[model samples]
Target: MECLLGLLKVKVVRGVNLAICDPLTHSSDPYVVLRLGQQKVKSSIKYHTINPEWNEELTLSITNMMHPVKIELFDHDTFTKDDSMGDAEFCILDFVEIAKRDLSDVPDGTVMKTIHPEKANCFATESHITWKDGKISQDIVLKLRNTETGELVLHLHWVNIPGVAR
Candidate 1:
């Protein structure tokens, strides 16, 4: 069974310094797969590039708030199975909780919450949830765990549905 709570808009902004999966070319044809509970989505494959800019906005219906959004990076291959570059995950409970507050009068770019890199998360650095451009958003840079090198930048937005808990 799967859970469907609400909608969450995940902006897969870009990747930074991704690993070299294709040894022959010394680069990777990369793409990201996002998984939140049972709902899964993937970005388009960027060919022959380590640093891929997806800039794609993916809307995922929140299934379980307790479950973290899992990110898996892979190098697209034609000859064989896609090579797994690395993986990362982020919990959205904190982001959703703060975004639900009264932020109408909040100043733009105001940092509402600060999440640091720790064992509980795959954050590469300190993440700031801000009220930017008349909306609540969080810019998170996740360091790919159990890999040589890679970082994923994502922007998260919580869309509160009518009758849903705000």
Candidate 2:
């Protein structure tokens, strides 16, 4: 059995101006799949839109804090394999670090960390790890790599496991 570490509640809020992978209809049926190690969680497919609001919450188990989370957007096809829209990756180390803090005095909506878009990262714009509603979380707008004209917005919530100290 795997040692209980933590749970990452990933809220896949929406996609912004995604690529039109389908040529005939000029739109794409897109779905998001998030991978952490050997675990994969997928969201429902939203059809015929460049901008789709998923509002999906995918939970991923955390055994290694250093593991990178991978996000991929695919165009769901009925008769063929799903076409890849693009992919991006992120790390939860900073968020996890803040979650391990004693933030009794930290104000709600306080920004703990601000991450900017660099060549080494997938952030489309800036991101903030904030303390909100008595939890550590972050909102990010990731610029998709290997594709033109697409961005993904998501929220990362850190859930601690009881009886296990990390």
- List TM-score per model, in order: 0.91, 0.95
Model 1 RMSD vs true structure:
1.9
**lDDT against true structure, model 1:** 0.87
Deviation in Å, model 1, residue 68 alpha carbon = 0.3
70 in model 2: Cα distance from truth in Å?
0.5
Model 1: how far residue 159 lies from native, Å: 1.8
Candidate 2 structure quality by residue, lDDT tens digits, 13-116: 99999999999999999999999889999999999998999898999988877888999999999999999999999988787778888798998899999999
